[model samples]
Target: MTLGNRKKNAVKAATAAKVDALLVTHLPDVRYVSGFTGSNAALVLTGNRAVLFTDGRYTAQAKAEAAGTRVVIEKKPAVTAACEWIERAGIQRCGFDAAHTTVAALEAMRKAVTSKVRRSLFHPVGALVAALREVKDADEISRMRVAAALGCSLFDQMLSIIEPGMTEIAVAAELEHQARLAGAEGMSFDTIVASGERSALPHGHATTAKLPRQGFVTLDFGVILDGYCSDMTRTVHMGNALPGEHEAYDAVLEAQEAAVAVVAPGVTAGDVDEAARSVLRRAKLDRFFTHSTGHGVGLEIHEGPRLAAKQTQPLAEGMVITIEPGIYIPGRFGLRIEDMVLVTATGGEVLTPSPKAWIQL
Candidate 1:
């Protein structure tokens, strides 16, 4: 959606929440509404006015990047400027994202205004713009598709370079270099290159550990492109895999695919999680499957509508999420198969449709 539409939606939400204005201090929220991708920014939204506040450092940048919004460059902190502006505009009940705002930050915001308005001026609004951002627009989906494609191509390149003796950090460095050459703004998160027993750690980042001659190498990474993020994980065997290892990989792949198949409009996020968990449960690997099945992805790597047990949020079209399932057997082996799936009207479409077939090198 256009920036104007986003601001309009935020205003409508603020109105519904019984607030006259919204003070957005979160950088991502500010970017979502005002199109300002600066490091320091605060966006104040009302029914009729949308103003972006930033420091003097972003004077020209804010004006050029923030479209269809009023840009106010101030010498003071952006949040302080935004709060003062709200008080001057006669806004009494301004909403702030309490989830993102800390106690000290709130105190500073309240201190920016007069004592008469400080006590009752700011209302707690939880993730107003972030909730709106959960559903990707056509433009956002297009950008995410490109990011996912770039991740898949990087994985393809890594397959040829991975060997038994390569250090995990070296592997990650090469992958990151390739991503930069391919035009990624940055990585979504620190690259994960868990080899052999290290694969048991779900978030094991790239270290100096060397790849084993015959064990699983889990590669979990993502790339940032055009202000969007893409996440996917694939585990490959270095040399030869035992029969049990092959079975475990098969089970995880099946579980990941099962979860991807259930993604569609009107489906509950819990149902999607169960679709994957049930597969692993049948394989007697449920205990090894840790973490949620997936989460909404867009401007941020992790968003709302999380796919996990007892989560009642329903999936909607235009939401992109990851379907990742794995079994990590500590001190033995582990493998994860993931795909960036876009929720569609009919079902789900895999954005990262690289080869998931068994790859032994």
Candidate 2:
């Protein structure tokens, strides 16, 4: 769906939620609704009307991107400008993102308003958008599929170039660069380049750690193309691998596949997670499992309807999420395999398009 349609959904949500107007101040949320990709912007959604506000820096962009929505250039903070509109429009309750806006910003906004309109720190309008975003339309699914194809091939490209002496940071930079070269808008998150003992950290930063001669190197990466994102993880051996390393990698991959096989609409997020964790548990590697099975992915890297224990949401058709199962052993090394999966009417569709087998390069 286009930004105009997203705005319409927001307006519909505002009316249902009893909100006079949703003052969305989160940059991603603003972009999601109005296509106004600015560092600072806010979206105001009335029942059937919407307006986008941004400062002078993005005045031109706002005008260009914010079609089917009203655009206003702000001279100061967006909340300040929103206050002006609320007073003039006689809005009694203006919704705000308490999760994104600071307490000081809210207080300042209250003081700025005419005391006629009530300022409420409602949960972000993005939360509503997030729920909507979970189920991808045909166009969104297509973008993610392209991202998946590029990401899958791009990974093989990076794997073919790994050398014994390359630093983790260098590999990460090269991976991102190639992703951009291969049509990736950007990376969804910091590309993980963990080697040797550093691999024990699930979300390890790309550091100066050089590739080990024969241990595990976990490369968790994602690609953003056409506004959608793709995620994949592959653990490889820098050289001929060791037995324990191979075994660990094998278990993780098997567990990931086990989960992937059972993903479908009408399943609970917890059930999907269990499908994988049970495999690890059977292998007696459950202790090393430090995180949830995976998470939802869409406009933002980590979206809603998480696949984890006690996740109260159900998997639905058109919902795209990740199936990353890992085993991290502190002080030694870690093994993880992640891939993007789109829940379909039939079953789950893999979006990463990468091979999960342990490859030695």
Candidate 3:
């Protein structure tokens, strides 16, 4: 969709919510609507007009990038200027994202307007623009595909160089360096290189700990390309795996694949989670499978339509999400197998189709 269409859709949503205008201060939402990518920005949307507010630092950049909106460069803060503009435009009720707005921020926003309308001007709209962003357009899906492919290539390269004696941080550094060389804008998040017992930590960041000779090394990472993010996790063994180690890896793989199989249009996110959890439950490892099954991924690493127990959000076509299932046995070992799966009309398509089989480095 073009930037103008996106703004039009947002305005339609604001109208449905009984608001005259929407004050979008979230950076990603701002980018999605107006194509403005600067650090400071605020987009005000009405039925007939769209205006982007920013400081002088982004005067030229905002004007150039924000294609469908009128650019207003002001010396004051962007949000304050946007609120003031809304009042001047005679907007009675302006919607703002309650999820992203803070108490202090709301107070400041109200202070920007006159006392008569300050108390009731800004209405609390819950994730108005974020809901629109959950489903990927063709352009967004194309960019995400490239990002996922880069992550898969990086994983393939890491298999050749990872050894038992290498430090976890060193492995992360090499992976990041290669990503930069491969034209990645940055990493989606801090690279995770959890080894040995540290694998039990779901979000174990790269540390100085050395890789173990006979334990699992979990590499969970993502990359950003063309303003999109890709996330996948692969756990490999250093030397020989113990008797139960191989079995655990197999169980996690089965669970991850099972979840990926159920991803399709009209499927509930909870059903997908249950599909993975049922596999681990059959293996008697469900207790160790901490965290949700997965989450939606796109402009942000984590988005809406969470795949977890009791989540009722239905999967829609064009939504990209992750299917990651793991078992963390504290002090003993842990393993995770993840893939970026795109929801399609028929079923899920694995974006990161690198080797998920047992890899003993």
Q: For model 1, give the 10-residue run with minimal summed lDDT.
A: 238-247
As for candidate 3, its clashing pairs are none
- lDDT (10s digit) by residue, model 1, range 154-238: 9999999999899999999999999999999999999999999999998989999999999999999999999999999999998
Question: Per-prediction RMSD in angstroms?
Answer: 0.7, 2.0, 0.7
Off by over 4 Å in 3: none
Global lDDT of each candidate: 0.93, 0.82, 0.94
Off by over 4 Å in 1: none
Model 2 lDDT tens row, 100-209: 67878778777777654444433334356656777888888888888888878878888788887899999999999998888788998889989988999999989988
Off by over 4 Å in 2: 116-126
Model 3 lDDT at residue 188? 98
The lDDT, on a scale of 0 to 1, for candidate 3 is 0.94
